[model samples]
Target: MKLQEKKELLKKTVYEMFPDAETELYHNNEFQLLIAILMSAQATDKQVNIINRNFFEFLKTPEDGLNLGVEEITEFISSVSFFNNKAKNIFKTCEILVAKHNSLPPKTIDELTELAGVGIKTAKVFLSVTEGAPYLWVDTHVHRVLNRIWIVKAKTPLGTDKIASKIFNAQDLAKLHDTLVLFGRYHCIARKPKCKTCPMLPWCSYKEKNLD
Candidate 1:
């Protein structure tokens, strides 16, 4: 199938399979979501959730986070991967938020990325989820699944984002990201994907090439 046809098919199939797809990261508001996504880097949603359950109560907003010392935050999230670095970044980010944005999370990508530990991907997550910004937020799951499905052949997440943005319009980006992440996590897996039962198997280049 051609790229356009494949993209349409992938989008339709995913919408059918998971019509109400949303982020798995637990957060009641934008601030918590941003923090959760930051902590989720190099860690799983389950792991982040496990730690956040206890940690979030103490730090829901930038002001709240500012009150929690970096050492205390580190102690709270020590069980998670890279707790030391994440804690420090979180503290610095809170300081930035409190000082610059008056304890409110910035809505734009530029302002969001300006915070400590916030990268393009993290900013994209906040933008897409919070402000309803249209963007293809590429994570490991997005990069892997886009390549596997032949929507993008990039070797890196940044490359995948660029390629996907070219093929898919801004309006479709948030849905596409959610769909691909769900597919990568559940169906189009890293090893031994459920190709036989996968809806995208017919259009998947990885499955055709015997990569899955």
Candidate 2:
């Protein structure tokens, strides 16, 4: 299949399989969502959700993060990777959101990335989910999936992210990130993809497919 054809198939299959595809990170508001995305860096959704399930109960706004302080935030999310740095960033992010954006996450990538700990990917994902922005945000799963399917020949997620922005259509870009993330996470996994049962195997270009 051609690149566009494969993209269509992948998009259709993933959307059909996961009609309600969205970020698995647990959060009730954009503030919490931004914080969660910040924390999710170098971490997994399952791990992030494990901590946020209870942590977010009291953390409803920037004032809540400010009230808790970095030390308290660190203590709250100490179980995950880079908790120390994440704590400082989250606290400062809340500060910026409160001081400048009125405790609301900015919709534009530039304004969103102004917050501490929010890189381009995090800002894009937050905007994509909250505002339905059509940005092709790429993570490890998305990068790997795209590369394995011969969609992009890049060594890094950022490289693939740049290429994917133009490869996919604007109308489908909003749904592509989450749906592809689900497919890559659950089916076309890094270690042992279910190639034998995968419907995308015919179109997959990976040389080392696991049939067993």
Candidate 3:
């Protein structure tokens, strides 16, 4: 099949499998969403949600985060990876949001990335989930799936991001991002992919596909 044809088939299958694909990190609002995404760096959604369950209650607005201060913030998210730095960045991010952005997460990538912990991936995921922006947010999951499906051939997620953006239609980028992440996380997993029953087995090119 043609490349675009394969992409369409892959997209349709993934969408059918996970029609409600979205960020697993729990957040009540965009402010919390941004903070959650920041904390999700180097941490799993399960881990982040564990902390956010009670942590988000103490933070409603940027002021709430500032009120807690870095020390307390660190304490709250101590279970997550790089808690000290994440807490410090969250504190600074809140300050910027309150003093500059009027307590709203910036919608544009450039402005969003200006915040303390909001990198390209974080900014894109925030916009894609919260605002439905047509951005190709490439994480390890996305990077793996795209390469396995022959959508892109690159050594790094950043390279995959650039190529996938050029290949996939802008209209499909947001859903594709969510779909591929979920697909990679659950079905097309890194270690032992569910390949025997996978719908994409026909199109998948991963050498280590678990056919057993």
Candidate 4:
């Protein structure tokens, strides 16, 4: 099948497989979501969820985060990877939000990235989930899945995001992102993918070329 044909088929199958794909991270609001996404960097959703269960109760706004101090934040999230840097970023980000954005999460990517620890991926996550903005947020799962499936030959997350944006429409961005993430996490895993059971096995170039 052609690339476009394969893409369409994969999209349909993914939707059928996971009709309600959502971010695994737990959050009560936009600020919480932003913080969760930030903490999720180089970390798993399970780990973030565990840490946030207690941390979030004390943090309701930017001011709350700022007041918590880096040391306390580090202690709470000490189980996660790069806890020190993440703690510093969270503290600094809250200060920036209070001083510049009036303690509100910025609406645009440029403004969002100005805050500490907020990069393209984090900004995209906030935009896509909270603002309902169209963005191809390429995380490790996305980068790995796209390359393995031959949707893109890119070796970097930025490169994968660029390629995905070219093929996916603005209207399809949210659904496509969720679908791909779920697929990568469950079936098209990074280590040993379930090629024998994956629905995309027929169209996946990596499976056909490498696994077969």
Candidate 5:
């Protein structure tokens, strides 16, 4: 099949499978969402949500982050990986948001990346979730699913991200942002994908599909 045809099939199948696909991270606002995404680097959404349950109650805005400070923030998120660095960066990010951005997250990728701990991927995720922007910030699940579906054949998530940007249009990126993540996370899993029951099984290009 053609690339567009394959993409259409993939999108259709995933959308049907997970019509309500969205970020699993729990957050009350954009600021909290950004922090959650930042902490989710080497952690899972479940882990981040567990931490944020109490953390978000105490840390709501940039001023709140400043009030908690790096030490307190570290204590709050001690269970997360790289807690010390994440705390410091969160504090610094809050400082910038308060001082320059008037305590609001930036909309553009360039402006968002200027914040501490916010990289291209984080920025894209933040914008996509908060602003409905067209961005498919490829993480491990996304990278694995895209490769399995033969959408992109890159080695690393970063490489797949580059190719995806070049091939997929803005609308496709926006639409697939949540759906693809959910599909990969739940359906086309890394070690044990539900290949036998998957609707895309016929068209899927994965060689070692877990049919068992």
Candidate 6:
């Protein structure tokens, strides 16, 4: 089958499996969402949500985060990995948001990345979720899934992001941003993917199919 044909089939199968897939991180607003994503670095959604369950209640706005300061923020998110740095970045980002953006998260990638902890991937995720922007952020799961499915041949997530951008159009990116992440996270897992039950098993290029 052609590359486009494979891509379409993959998309159809993933969408059917997870039609309601979205960011599992709990947040009430854009500020909380950005903070949650920042803290989610090297952490799972369940981990972040566990901390944010109480942290977010005390932190609703930029001013709230700014007021919490680094020490208090660190205290709240101490359970997460690299809590100290994340706390500092969250404080600095809140400061910038309050001082420049009128306590609102920036709308553009350039502006968003200018914040303390927001990188290209983080910015893409934020925009894709908040504004319905057509940006796909390739994390480890996405990179693995794409390579296994023969959709992209790259060693790193960054490389996969670049190649997938060239292959998939804007609409596909929007639809895929969340679905692909969910598909890779839950279905095409890293250690032992559900290959036997996977709809794409026929076309999958992954050599070590756990069919047994």
Tens-digit lDDT track of model 3 for 72-187 = 99999999999999999999999999999998898899999999988988998999998789998899999999999787999999999999999999999999999899999999
Q: TM-score of every model?
A: 0.93, 0.95, 0.97, 0.91, 0.97, 0.97
True lDDT of residue 206, candidate 4:
87
- Backbone clashes, each candidate: 0, 0, 0, 0, 0, 0
| Residues 98-138 of candidate 6: C-alpha lDDT, one tens digit per residue | 99999999999999999998998789899999988988889
RMSD of each: 2.0, 1.2, 1.0, 2.1, 1.0, 0.9
Ranking by lDDT: 6, 3, 5, 2, 4, 1
Model 1 error, position 134 (Å) = 1.3
Q: What's the lDDT for candidate 4?
A: 0.86
lDDT of 4 by residue, 1-212 (tens): 78888778878877998898888888998889999999998889999999999999988899998788999989988999999999999999999999999899989989999999999889988888876678768888888888877878898988998988898778888777877888889877777777877777777778443353
Of 1 and 5, which scores higher on TM-score?
Answer: 5
Cα lDDT tens digits for candidate 1, 1-212: 88889889888887887788889998887888999999999999999999888888899898887788898999999988999999999999999998999788898889999998999889988788776678878888889888988888999988988888888988998888787788778876777677777778777778444333
Residue-by-residue lDDT tens digits, candidate 2, 167-209? 8888788799889899899999999988898778998899999
* Segments of candidate 4 deviating more than 4 angstroms: 207-212
**lDDT of predicted model 6:** 0.92
Q: Higher TM-score: candidate 1 or 2?
A: 2
Alpha carbon lDDT of residue 86, candidate 1?
96
lDDT tens digits by residue: candidate 5, 1-212: 78899888888898898888779999999999999999999999999999999999999999999998899999999999999999999999999999999999989989999999999889999888887798888889999998988989999999999998888888778768899999888888878999999887888898898888
Is candidate 2 or 6 superior in TM-score? Answer: 6
Score each candidate by Cα lDDT.
0.85, 0.90, 0.92, 0.86, 0.91, 0.92
